[model samples]
Target: MATPVLPRSVQRLIDEFARLPGIGPKSASRLTFYLLRATDNQALDLSVALQELKERTRLCSVCFNITEDDPCPICEDEARDAHLVCVVEEPLDVLAIERSRAYGGRYHVLHGAISPVEGIGPEDLRVTELVQRVAQGQFTEIILATNPTLEGESTALYLQRRLAEYGVRMTRLARGLPVGGDLEYTDEITLGRALEGRQEV
Candidate 1:
């Protein structure tokens, strides 16, 4: 018996699948075969959507969120409270908070947190932009909604100390958030409660 040879096209698909997070080589091979058995339109649609995602999306200039527009809809929203800026670790965090329907303020997405092991420092995030915004003295309160994990806590603490001289009210999310959990994974009800119970930094 001889081993079956995968075509170059199939091998390319497997490579792409492997590039996705959490998709090991075995899983990638499985996905490639799954797609091969799927309808042609399904695969085409997936490809088109992936292409459009990169072509149509860009970082929001104001909040640094992934959006179709430069400023993002949230940054341009007049109904939200401009005096309050909820700072979070990622764009997904913004979505999570928005889903709660409890926060009515604007947002600033940090993109990442400070992690020494990961070689991610404050310079690698949107921290400088946040400092500039605070220097403008336009916001009255900054809600540090970063996750409750060690890295998240460290990032929040660093921001607190750095912005302390800005004279604006600084706050942190309430302590009831599950320890070591990502904000994006938390339930809206729990997130809402945490927001409501936010305390001064």
Candidate 2:
């Protein structure tokens, strides 16, 4: 049988949804149809929320994490240990670390790991900004909290070499995190232990 045609607008939304990570064509179609059936106010509410998400948020100038301000709230908070910086791969990783409540330091979000296969390299991320931050002589410790993947390890080693000249305390998150695991999925207990047991690089 020939494929049935969907409304142009509906099909457009479905295509957009299908492009998102982990969302397949079937799930995208389901979401599009669900939105089609939703009350006008409900659908409009979601539309407005999505618009505002892009309109109101930008990367933090300091850490490069998504934020509504130049510096994110975490960067501005005086209570956090400014001398200690936990370097993570993304904003999601920052949330993961915060959930553990075991770290009271500032964060530097690299936004992504160095994946040569994916065409992502040090220049593609916020590495230069991190080097500049360390050169400022404000932070005393640099914690390499990037995920435990091969790419993550590669990125961490690259950072270690790049930042070695600053004469700062550099440490890596301990071995409790699985070798192939992403930090975003690690449980609080395990993540907390890893934070506590971090060792010098």
Candidate 3:
């Protein structure tokens, strides 16, 4: 059945919302209607926030993470371990690592992983910039913190080969079972990695 006649402005908003990833037509319609019924300040706040998000954020010139400044605070901080760099797939991955507070090093955001199926490759990412940074900087180690997936592995391997000539030590994030997960429910790969990475207790 056709959708009931909606005003052009309302339909436009619904269409825009539907264009966003994971937002279906029904969800888009609901969101548009919700904003329509919301207070003027609320809707205006959302619009302004979106506008500022685009206008104020840019990829950091050093690490390629989203930031309002060129080098970003992490790259600028004197307290951070400048000799260590954690390389990840996206800006969100940087955020995830930061929340853990277990690492006090810098970061390099690739924006994406190698995925031939998606037509994304080394050139499509920030690999060249990373290589240049390594060559010019005094980093002692590059931590491959990419996701534990096929594409992530491929990207890490490619990076390892490219940075091999620099002789900088490279390390991968250890994979294992989660603390709350049971061994019986764990996949074979996770179990194997956990065993391989086991520490003396």
Ranking by lDDT: 3, 2, 1
List TM-scores for all candidates, in order: 0.84, 0.86, 0.95
lDDT score for residue 143 of model 2: 97
Clashing residue pairs found in predicted model 3: none
Model 3 misplacement above 4 A = 1-4
Worst 10-residue lDDT window, candidate 3? 2-11
TM-score-based ranking, best first?
3, 2, 1
Q: What is the C-alpha lDDT of each candidate?
A: 0.92, 0.93, 0.96
RMSD of 2: 5.8
Model 1 lDDT tens row, 67-166: 9987899999999999999999998898899898999999999999999999999999999999999999899999999997789999999999999999
Quote the lDDT for 64 in model 1. Answer: 90
- Over 1-201, each residue of candidate 2 has an lDDT whose tens digit, in order, gives 978687778889999999999999999999999988999999999999999998999999998889998789999999999899999999999999999899999999999999999999999999999999999999999999998789999999999999999899999877678889999999987898889888889
Instruction: After superposing candidate 1 on the true structure, give the runs of residues whose Cα lies further than 4 Å from its correct spot.
Output: 1-4, 177-201
